[model samples]
Target: MPGEAPYLAVADVLRARILAGEWGVGERLPSRARLAEEYGVGRNVVQRAVDRLIIDGHLEGRAGSGTYVRSPRERLRLVRSRHRERPAGFPLRPGTRERGRADAWDAHSQVRVSAPAEIAGRLDISPGDLCVTTHYEFLAAGQPVQLSASWEPMALTDGTPIVLPEQGPLAGKGVVERMRSIGVVVETVVEVPRPARATHAQANLLGIGAGDLVLLIERTIYDTRGRPVETADMVIPDRHREVVYEFGVDLP
Candidate 1:
């Protein structure tokens, strides 16, 4: 459209004012009446303009206080290399590459759990088949940053020393390394990433607002024979983190 609405036009100037540092982050905007007079618009128009900026994430409203420029969120990067999660000590393997190396992690595994149909399909097992399910919460700088729930068929690791994901000698060692201990060679990892809104439970766990954006990662680990040995769903708060992918380029 050649001409924006009256309120939208006012919003544009107000946005420009904010971006130009007229009102810094966490600084309150002038009263609606004040802005209305300065912009030669009605108070309702000024209020609507401010509301639009709030919806666009440029501003936030506080109880009994005027709207203020939102503080720019500090986001950390969570990287996924084309080839990652290989067990340590593998010949020709690169440097230490695993999850949560930069943070602390807590994991709990429940044994003899029956797999649901959806999980069974991913693991290529019958519905209600026995498996071990593990829940993980990762903290970066002492704050919750990531969450995941992993599943592994008990038929493959029932009596092994590493059967429990977070307990035993190989406790907390990752799917690849534990499977390797039992002679199952892990060769591939596949991840599907999607955008999702934070659920109430997820919002509480990650300490974020409900409906906040998040990255949902559905990941599966496979063996050399193309059998899926483990599957996990990873969650990261989009407002607090960004996902980065890295690939190696080889010379011909």
Candidate 2:
């Protein structure tokens, strides 16, 4: 069943080319019929390959327009981590509170129990330090909309009331709120975002393929004395989320 189809071979070739930079971001791939002739296969076979790439995030299809490669933008600026004010009329009843408790965003589906090497480095904890990971897959109208992960030190959350999903987003919600209640006054929130490809595990969880473009956001919360308290790394599906920040800056 696996790799038996001619189209599968073609898909593999396309994947290699994209990784090899033969088709750089934003470049257009050859038409299906054209690729079919070149690959000595039927047009249907080539169409299948193209469809696979689209699901994998290597290509984008525009209505009435040709499919193009994905071009990710660089980090726009040094962003400060802050709670995004939910837009008025934006759906709130179905927030993380409801979904996570209902077993909709269960650890079995959304969270990873193991910590990889890279994640360990970001957390500044020893490799394999106990980390409780909670992942969320936000869907909009039956379509996969957004993917995110939240991690907290096991020592901090283990057997704590805050471990419960319902306690996550209460009044003055988010990590900041809970920390403040515990006498941890957060003074700074740092955010860093980069363009990244999904890992094999991430791909399986997000229902996307590896090498697909995704946004990697790392947020670090620091205490009043500037000591890091917690870190959260979120892998967002670009197709579903358009990131924007609103803040007031004083001008000289």
Spell out the clash pairs found in candidate 1.
none
- Error in Å for residue 222 of model 2: 1.9
Collision pairs in model 2 = none
- The TM-scores, one per candidate, come to 0.75, 0.54
Clashes of each: 0, 0
Q: Write the per-residue lDDT of candidate 2 for residues 1-252, one digit (tens) a residue.
A: 144788889988888888899987888888888888888888888888887878666777777777788775322221222434656875433222222111133232222255567766766667777776666665544544456676666655566555533345442256777777667788887778898887888777666666667888887777787766667777765544545543455699
lDDT of each: 0.85, 0.64
Q: After superposition, how far is residue 151 of candidate 1 from its true place, in Å?
A: 1.1
Per-residue lDDT value at 193 in model 2: 84
| Deviation from native of the Cα of residue 194 in model 1, angstroms | 1.1
